[model samples]
Target chain A: MTIIANAPYDFTSNDRQEDFRGAMLVYVGWARHMMFASPYCWPLPPDMPFGALVEGPMAQAFAQHPDWEQADWSTATWTRNGEPFTPDLSKSLADNGLSHKDSLMFTTPGLDGIGGMGF
Target chain B: MDIAVTKKKLGLKERYALMTRGLGWEPTYQSVDDVFPMDSFEGIKIHDWDAWEDPFRLTMDAYWKYQAEKERKLYAILDAFAQGNGHLTLSDARYINTVKLFINGLAPLEYMSHRGFAHIGRQFRGVGPRVACMMQSLDEMRHAQTQVHAISNYNRYYDGMANFRHHHTYLPYLQVPRSFFEDAASGGPFEFITAIGFAFEYVLTNLVFVPFISGAAYNGDMGAMTFGFSAQSDEARHMTLGLEVIKFMLEQDPDNLPIVQKWLNKWTWRGVRVLTLVAMMQDYMLPKRVMSWAEAWEIYFEENCGALFRDLARYGIVMPPCVEQVRKERDHLSHMAWCQFYQARGTNNFHVWLPSKEDMDWLSAKYPETFDQYYRPRFEYWAKMEEEGTPFEAATPPQQCQVCQIPTIFPVAGDPLTRAEHSCTHDGERFHFCSQWCQEIFEDEPEKYVQAKLGAHELYKGNLFGDADPTAEDFDPMAAAMAFLKLTPEDSGLHSDSRDAANFDLWRGLAKANEA
Candidate 1:
């Protein structure tokens, strides 16, 4: 039950425990799912303050925002071995249980942002 | 002669028993291990071969009669479809692209299954299972041949419909399926049975076949529908064999449970990964969508897989690993794949385009939660660019997954512009995968995947088009790529802006005029 920190920009290190392979793969799929849906969420206008919210509230806000349209937050209710995982987006992915060495499933919002399915 | 003629006809049970267990006995000349070396390597223990049950009890004579009758009916429909110019009746010309995907991606895998089942039929020690495998081997061959015959009708009118078997061998996108079957075929006997017999046939074949048939029925392509219908009966038998094989292996010994579970996980993921093509076809290619890929996945996988896992729980097996990932991905995969094809048509052999406004609305309705929000803008962006006379197509090939060979376009969840690249160092060389499952697959058997011929690597190393320098003025990478595929512009890869788009517009214009 060791909890690893998340680092969105880094992927050099990842969890390789034999027992965690299945759950780790689930997280990887979630990472891809989020990246795919990120384009729908436009960058906040320059002066707006950036904030992180729990997935339940974020989903509601996204649904109401006509511009955001039908964003999928299925993976936003993230799970670790079928248990719910809520990470703080305000901090680096490492603070949220994603790390370059152990877990690589977060996004660095400004510098690299997210790479898309469209190369 | 008169006395001998008084013998009665053998009943079904007696005939099957004699044909199966009646012929088997312990061998005196060679050790059982020597006789069946392939079975033991996987650590599957079987105390008695007689315990195997031949479920079909289908003799060669009955098999021929059953199959030939079905083929006669299918060929009759195929002949009608061809002779009546039924291609003209499809929902749209773009509908043929779905057929193209089928012929190129799936048909050849059927042929490969034929070879796989044949090999395993000889490899297994039990006579009952051997006979069943032999029957399934023939069924697979028939599926391949009939699929080709049915779709060959399109070859007469379409650009990318020709030379499917050849395309499957060399096409980059097609490598997803080719590598999958090759992995299964090259494995031990039990692995092959579970990989093809169980995971592929029983679990995932419906995802592929159902969409095509229903899509055909909706689009008025009787040829494909007929071919699919003809194959369905045999598919049921193959699926039964798959289920029976798994249950038999599990029931035989407790030690066999974990190994079988591992195979179930490996092959289930592998098979589902390949179904990315079907998902794309169902969601994007068909002119008349039968169901969204998400809904189909829910029916075929989530609901069905839940029941299947419950049944297997008694044997101490859970669901295939990471299947929840597949459940989560159902809403997103088809759209992602369709967008990838639209953007990268230059590197592929199929036609793709931005969905029409109506089609987009339909998608939004079908995927109410995700489409308009996450996927539509991408399509809108592409379509707007096209309208402004600056259509977007990739100038360079995207880096492909080391194992699956798909491009690195899969999104990292929550980030639309960035995708995940999972990699590992194997034998001093770095390898990349599109997802953790593929990466883990490589880690598990680095030897099996290390030698894969990635398209980019091949071109960079000057192994293509007679080793000509990639920088030479006369050298064209696309041409080099096509040269390896034996494809020419006339009858090969269909371009989105080419005749396909024009024909679709033409059909739409006529429909509009009729409506007016």
Candidate 2:
């Protein structure tokens, strides 16, 4: 499936982790929350605690959703890059095995979005 | 005494052969491989350049006469539309946003097509295709110009219409189409023809053009409708060239079938991703809808392309595997794409708004199986939020697919609620895709896609804001990004709140008073 080229095609990926200047790109999706359109991508320090992300950026990202107020993060189920996982609140993103460009989807079992229609 | 001699005129076939095939000569001064080095590199084998059947018998002299005539008629209409204050005659200011999308997103691709054709026209060893590509190159250039001339009248009275050329380069959402053309233009000659010619022009052009043109007609836009009419003949030639190039490649050698098939798969998925914008426009942007995106897909893609693939089947080319996924998505593509645009409206050059009750009813009727059940509820919730003065806006940019450059807004096939997410790590770096099709395209050409300048990635990295320091403590990144994209505050936000809407009301009121 290699590209047919006259010469060898080689280059560095444009968005490699080092290009972020000390921040790692992480994507967060609130599962069943179609209201948000798609997963939000942000650049954050890998050493930042997972709880801080949920409290700071992730909370702000989903604050407009009506179900955000009713959702309990502690009881939420999580998947990292489509695999099930549990995050220790105190653990840094790096400690929780979250790498650059890795996507995390969280679902609050009780909060199924507005009108329970998965919005 | 003489000889009075009258020379007989050349017949159509003779003139075509003399004008096309007669133009080529054996390269004795330079080796043929040295002159046409690009043709062989893509692994397509052409045993005889002479075997290429000229699709159109158009000569340069006749081409100039025909195109000049089209331009003359088109410009006359454009001038009349302007003098007649045609911008005031549009059904609504919301319809202008669709034109904005066209000028910003699609017109620039026409220019890119011009460049691609011009490049490949010289690269092909066959004189017949060379002549065909050269004509198509001129046609594309003319299309780009006429479109700009047509929409330039709207630019005077609209906010988003201004800065289209700039937006095509830097606008985040526009990168979907920008990158699609760039991907095609950067490929080899065969891949370029197959990607833009066979896949985009032949298979998908109707979906893109029919909606915009018919929407223009339905929405009372004479300028855009006239431009559409002007371009229709050129599009027919381009489609014929598309089919001709594909058949020529396949018929030339058996080895080309698999290569062409691979490209068909890749470009079909790629073209579909780019058309998500057009789908959204058909469904949401047009005030007086011509047809629903689902209906357009059923007609343009499902029916027309279905027949085309069947025709191609005898040449051992089956439908692209991605067609199944596209069928699953046909019902929901526009809804999802419009939702994405609506949520991220602040960042886009064009304005977005919640569909009216009537519009929602139209959507319900159009998309019986999914619209009311899946999309209407979401729109209703957003409308409620807008009523409460807390309209939902995405706080951060969505992750973009590396291949398509579209925000990963597509839902999983047959599953309307969940977003489709696929990613793969190459050389210890992760690249995300909207679906398995995009992932496969990337897997095939990791070398090419890995170098993608993803818009969101660039936004975060501070590369998008030209000469501005994003790291400054007081600097606002979003504002700076907007400045870089040349989008004024008037250019974006809710359609109801936009300056275009305000001006439209004022002018129409004035015109009515004058009539009285």
Candidate 3:
């Protein structure tokens, strides 16, 4: 279980402050942690607790970035199958029905109202 | 009584004029723009219609006579192969899956090519390009018919060969190639030429035809080899048309370069994406391999097209933007795509098998960097599972790309094991794509691609296999899916490893007997 990171545009990395932008990022082959990214991003590990996924490397990557740290996390919305994600950060993504072949999206409030970075 | 009449033969220039310009007439009542309204809509500016050149200079009579002769020769070979029991001469019955793929996937596209070219032939104002399109239309028809006639021998004894035309339209996997050609056919004339003639024929035809024909030769599929051989000259002509048309368009107006470049980028990626079937066939399906998929890509595409791009730089045409990803993924695409096929073989018309130890060794030799490390273990896992009496099949269909309609099996960058997923937010509904190129293709024209009937998406909506129709009483989704695929228990059904399994056992038995 590995995932490849292919972004069609240049976006700041969630965990790494390094500017990651290209049509293809890196071949993330054969990994146990897999999730789906839409509008161009990488799949994250679904087995990890939702809190770790949000507050862990992913959130840290987006949080400490020079340009993106100003974004407010309180206005974020996560949904699975059109239902809003519950704030029970203790549950693993797999426990919440975010498995391989399933699609999930996370969006924070943005000026455009379509929200901030989502996938 | 012998009657002698002084008959004069038409000179080459005179014959060309009479055949092309002689046959065409300007509309007396309508403006030329009204007569050829569809050609200009794509924003390609053709300043001079007469500037479009036809190198072949073929006329209707000559085209018919030459094509008739080609058909005659091809049919003779087909008949001889059938009467001589050529099926027994093949490397193995498993080898026919390659043939099945060609018939089921590519042959119908030839017919579509004919229809597309015919549409363009009628629409273009230039007699030269128009005649060339007409000739290509005829060539495509011949290619399609010859491919069917050649492979018709297999339909005689095989189960899956019976209903390919039906499968091509309705089957989920087939939507990959079907939607590609259908998109081309529905475009304006200039875009149509760029899509088929320039992008497909000029750039990628060799990648598709060469491997299959070489495999046919290596595997002793003489009937298929003959048809492939007969179709080569026409392919060459089509390639010429492709190159010529691109040059013509670029040279016609400076404004045309960007439009042609856009089509070049889009169709080049689309054409290569459609060749996933060929990639799988070359790597996994062929019993006696002719060449590794990577090697073929290097020799045919990387080396040749690199030079082609350098030549086109003068006209502001660069290599396709997707070429880098294509080169990087060459080692992985076949393995990833084949794994998907192996998982979904129950739904496919072909059989699947794990690489034999010898075949694995060959793969290791061919793919020194990646095969043993990444792909081999996956095959071994399946082989061991099969040995343990618990075979693997995906419980559900994989997510499909909205534009290409292929399963999203491509590996993510920096990680080959974890599959990469890409999508775009269009109309507030998230649409998934297989790659950046496919995503851009959809984004460039959202209206055309938004309506894609992806197999996985359709299954989710219960539209697959006519399940969307609530009025039909017997439209059980499962039963309808099976019925539409023509996969009955006794008739056209699933192909498995039993044939190879039996052959291996027989070989071992013969070896033991000789030793004893």
Candidate 4:
């Protein structure tokens, strides 16, 4: 007879656009290892629909944002547990199948590199 | 004649009793041995198949109907979640990337088990176990389907979930789980059970499932939780099968204990090494916290297995000797292994998904001996590099462990900095690697890991350096695949990297880094 959401609700909400953007940045940082850390970067294999986030139209669509830089990820903007980890972005370069070059940026929350817990 | 009273309609349990215990007919023509031959390969002998106890004695009519109902409930949950932009409510779109990692790295193995259990279903001489496996075979297919469907909701929101069976060619993390299953499936049924059922499902399932459920719960994605819980409830049954099968073998003969021990050691460590991603996922991947790998290992492996083995030891089956080694590794491995992922050239990064200091300090306190003593100081060294405007430079990974394919981040078992990364020579040619695990696996069994004449980066090394061929035509992924599978170059097989076949090289390479 009781609903989980309405049961004396007290959980925090990320309702602001800034919160959403910040969360995105934190996720971007969380994904830092994904870009440069794997043998071949980009989250999925090239044939998968998800791989398009890196190589195809969506990649281009995101690339339209001006805020991103080739090394924007490595720029020490946030900290975790007071121990800083600048998403070792060297993986993002697209040159020589080594790093990424796409410049995709979004506005608001600065979630990337917020120390131990990025979000 | 007086009419006999009709037999009372049976409840589920009574039906389970009749269908399982009474339905199987005595073979009029063939002996049980003639019907099944795989039981003796690991030299495990069972005196009696009837003695095997199956707690969930599912009969066919009820089995099919319950399975149908479970599926109906599962699909409805998925539909409601998708109809809702439940995707956006998730911690972030990137969390879906973690789910993507789960699918590419882990899902195919579920499908493979569908075939594996089908074999076990038909081949087990015991009617009880065979029937259990038959139901399990069906469960495996449903698991594979549900896993894909659960993540497909993110196909529009993320990139990694799409056409991923083919993604093994491009993503190295994906290659890790794929190659592991490929090797397990290629081995005998006994090895498959050791590698999959015991090592993966029984020993490692809690560590995996806990993070998975919490990830769904924290992100507000009920669909994943429903699917995960369904698959996991079935997994509880599979774990029982693993334990029963192992005990059945041990009960058959005393010699079976040693063989099972070796398998337990090898697969346990291998499984743990691969689960490093889940380690990072629990520790750092989620925006909200989940149980740490250290805590999970303590409860799942230490406490549970400790008790299980204590029970087994009474039968003269000693506990797995490697338990202490595993307990030690769990302390520093998530940190070390995640670093391997962070530092390896083609591995995934832990950037945007960093955890908090309270969590890190908690990590340090929990793993005081390992973290405070070894890993923390080491990261400090790297931090010094980044602060000096020169985050420490990484070298090209040695080609040998390159077979294991993880960076040399894992130091010798006890020493974190000794960096014993080395190579061996076969016929005057040198092979290099980052860790002894990778090197020993590669050198002791070269045919196991090496696929001859391939490297996506090879042409650039030779005359093709100037060709501007965006397609990586020359690289072969067989070695990479072997490394991923806990196999090495010394052992030769059709799928091994040592194979001379060109198409094998091509497909194998595609399976690794997706070369054209």
Candidate 5:
């Protein structure tokens, strides 16, 4: 299944960690919130706290959703790169074991998008 | 003494042979393998170049004459349409967004196709297939030219059409088509023909061209309809060449089957993913919809491509495995694509809007199983938000598939509510895909796909902004990115709020009135 090239075909991934300067690319998706269409990718420092993400960018990203106001993060379930995990609110993303391009998905069990159909 | 000399005119078949395969010669100074270096890299076995048949014996002279005649007739109509202020004659101004999508997203691919064909034509050692490729290369170039000419008329009357060439390179949605063509063109000769000629031209051209052209006719766009007509004959030739090339390779050697099958699997998935834009246009953008995207898929992919695969089965080429996933997706592709476009409208060069109630009803009727239950409520909520002066616009870049390079917006199969997310770590770097098929394609060619210039990644990396410092305290990233994409405030937004809509109302009103 290798590429049948005349010569060696090798190259660095264009979006390698170093390409983002000092930031790591983290993708966040709200489970069942189809209104946003897809997960949003943001460049944030690895040292930034997980609570800062939930309060600042993630909150802003999902603010327009009807269920956002009623969303209770303390009761919400979370996954880091599709695996179940609990984040410490005060801990940095790196402390939560997140790396570059890793996806974080959150589901507010009670707040299932607008009209309970995942928008 | 009077001497009379008689010369016999060569018959069509003899003339064709003389003008085509007869033109090739054995190289004296260089080896044949050295000259056609790209021929063998893909591991396709070719025993005899002479066995390659020319599906259509269109020599350079005949090709020029026929195309020139077509050009003459096409231009005359285009000229008449232009002089008559034909832009105002059609359906609603929103119809022009479909044309904008075509010009910006699809037209540039025609140019890419030309380059692909031209490159492969020079690489193939077989005289017959080489000539066929050469003629197709010319046809592709002509198609690019005629498409630009036909659609450019709308530029004078539309906001989005003015910067299409620029948008084709920079727009995130446009990168889907741009990257698709670049992938095909960058592959070896065999892979290129199979990807573009067979998988695209033969299997999927109907889905792409039929909807756009028929949609044009339905919407009173005589100019685009005529362009479709002009290109129809060339497309027929291309399709025949597609079939001929595949059959030729299969008949030449048994070893070629598996390689071709793998490519067929890969390209079929790739082609369908790229056509998400067209699906959105057919379902949402067209004011006078010809058919729903689901209906088009049933006819084009299921019915037509079904027969094509059955025909190809004798050569041991089964229907691509991706079709099962595609069947699951047909009902929802357009909805997902349109929703993505609507939220990210500000970043695009074309306008997007919520489908009218009638449009939704049509969608409900067409997609009986899913539309009303899943999509309608979402659109209704967005409309309500718009009415309340709080419109939804996504400021952040969406996650894009590493292989296809489209935003990973597709919902999980059988579960329409959840977004499908497939990712794998390769060489310690993470790659994401919208579907398993795309991930498999990446897994098969990790080296090739890892080098992909993903648009969203590039945007986040601050590669899009030219001289502006993204780090400057006052600089806005989204605004700077939009500026980089050459999208003006008037160029993109809700269709109702667009300059195109405003101008259409003003101009059409004056055209009907007794005085200005």
Candidate 6:
């Protein structure tokens, strides 16, 4: 499958329509379960974490973390229709469009876009 | 419904672009703080208006136009259904007993929701959110009137539909919600929002709408569904408003966090207590089964809310403080509350029979957290014993909860007869409650939420109202209305001397209409 990486916040060269595709990642205040898809992609499973785990034990001892593998690393994929998808259905990054876009925020976490910053 | 008339087919475009933000002129005279007083409590600092986002971009005229069209369709359904022999589809005239409980307990609360939301609509400085609230307020009122009107047709057939206005004064079943909103509306605007908006919408709205409305849909109750789904489409907007309002408050002030959390706890318990009547309705009321409270809670709360809370945790909002305890009690609610109704029905008074075992079993399985484990045995035992004809007598209600107005379902982890536990002293009166959660709420701001509650306080003193209106005395409200309508024995079907079918046709002109 074509993994769409950090789909909600990232951008493309083509400034196409709004990306509600991964907007489920941005909840108002409560955790809500969402099953959604990119405009042309199938819904990605919830396990695939896009951000770094800043705190907790995993941050220190990356080993003893028995059987811990990224969700996308173990998947097999194929296509029946025109689309490609992972068997496990985890995180994905769709094809980059042509030169039409606004500034992307997922990459530049330090810059809040208005200039202040999120990270 | 006359399919052409419903606004759903017309698909009103959300017009907020024009009526809300579109109509909002820049407030040159007043600063943002002057216009919207509630902002600035959340620690998160934002200097730009663009940071505020409205997910449902609704406009005012779109709301009114669609809502108006929805009402017209509902009224037409009531008219056409009544004009036909729609009453025959009912399982029995006795079934209206459930509808009577509905009119008395739920109908008026809709109006209160409307009034409360109107206040919110005007208060929020943000045009997008305010307009959403305005639309919700309008829908709430429509829901109230439509419910009363839609059920009024059954008045001619059922013994109980006419008595809602009177029975509510003494009926424990009806008093549950009445006592609740009376307290909610009487309190401060914030308290009302916490009570009705956040508590009712965020927590309890699904319990009523999903089970109750779905039952109406499954039971061939067309007018009811048109009314419910039409109102519910707007209800999601209210839910959005609730989530937005709470988040907006928390985002504006960090100190508001602790305060809002307390309310989340208080209102959740209060609202759950008030919904006991709905629980009874689910487990025992409908002739055709719908989802049980446990199942509804599983899907709406465990799944939907579980996800919602986890997302909120990232932003620092916690679930209602005592949610785990609430989670544990879902199974107990349906059986116990329905027992209350069955008890009320025993005296040849008001109540509905339980749905078929199939519905009960479905509920048990779907709500594994509640039914399949803890509550299922009780259902199975009751079913088996009931088949052998054991007397199921009405148990006297425990002393009314001082705040929420239902019997304390709060179980003692150890003792049973204590009727739950409480030791909160408010103004020298050591208040008793059904659970630790409720007691904490009473203690937190006794003056605000608890002091004004009229629990079992005034009932023994002989001051229940509604008998004063001559209109309130009949056993069937629609029949009473027909008496006022002077439609003769034929139209007032409850008259002992019901006219023969042929004569009735002549009098009401049913034959001529058929020919036309």
**Which candidate should be chosen as best, given lDDT against the real structure?**
2
lDDT of 3 by residue, B1-516 (tens): 989989898887778888887777878999999888787767778888776667777778888888888888888889999998787777876787888888999899999999999889989888888888988998899889988888888887665667889889878889999999988876778888888986678656687778768788899888988898788769889988888888898898999998888888999899888877788888888889889888888887888778778888999898887888887888877877887787676678767777889889998898888788777766776677688876655544555777888877776654664446576665445666788889888888766776677665454444455534645875567676676567654332224544433553565466447753
lDDT of 5 by residue, A61-101 (tens): 98988788888878999887678889898999999888899
| Model with the higher lDDT, candidate 5 or 6 | 5
Tally clashing residue pairs in candidate 2. Answer: 0
Residue-pair clashes per prediction, in order, are 34, 0, 27, 71, 0, 33
Worst 10 residues of 4 chain B by lDDT: B490-499
DockQ of each: 0.04, 0.81, 0.04, 0.02, 0.81, 0.01
Ranking by lDDT: 2, 5, 3, 1, 4, 6
- Model 4 Cα lDDT, one tens digit per residue, B300-364: 87888788878888667666555555565677667766555444423331122222355568778
* Candidate 3 wrong stretches, greater than 4 Å: A1-102, A105-119, B1-14, B465-476, B489-516
TM-score of chain A of each: 0.26, 0.95, 0.40, 0.20, 0.94, 0.15
Question: lDDT tens string, model 1, A71-107?
Answer: 3333334433223556545553334553221212332
lDDT of each: 0.69, 0.87, 0.71, 0.55, 0.87, 0.52
Please say which candidate is ahead in TM-score: 1 or 4.
1
CAPRI quality of model 5: high
Q: What is the Cα-based TM-score of model 6? A: 0.63
Could you give candidate 1's per-residue lDDT for residues B295-353 as a string of tens digits?
A: 88888887777887798889998987768677667777888887767655765667777
How would you encode candidate 3's per-residue C-alpha lDDT over A1-119 as one tens digit per residue? 11111223323212121211211111111122112211112334556676666565454333322224544556756554334565456887667655333344445345221121110
Q: What are the per-residue Cα lDDT tens digits for candidate 5 across B1-516? A: 979979798888888899988999999999999999999988899999887767677778989999999999999999998998888888988889888888898778888898899898999999988888888888888888998999989987788877888888888788888888888888899889989987678766777777768888899888888888788678889988887888888999999999889988999999999888888889998899888888888788888888889988999999989888889888888998999999988787888999889999999999999899989998998898899999988977888899888888887888888878789998898888989999999999888889988777898788888778877999987778777778899888898988889999999888888783
For candidate 3, give the lDDT of residue B352.
77
Q: Write the per-residue lDDT of candidate 2 for residues B1-516, one digit (tens) a residue.
A: 889989899888888888888888989999999999898988898998888887678887788999999989999989999999998888988888988998998899889999999999999989989999999998989989999988888888888878888889888888889888888988899999889876678666777777668888889999998888788678888888888888889899999999999998898899898888888888888999878888788887888878878989998999999999899888888898889889888878889999999999999999899999999998888898899898888868888888998888887899888878798889898889999999999999899998988877898788877878866898987778778878888888899998889999999889778753
Tens-digit per-residue lDDT, A1-119, candidate 6:
12112123222311112222332111000001000000011112233342221122122222111122321223312221112322322222222211111111111112121112110
lDDT of model 1, residue B169: 77
The docking quality of candidate 1, as DockQ, is: 0.04
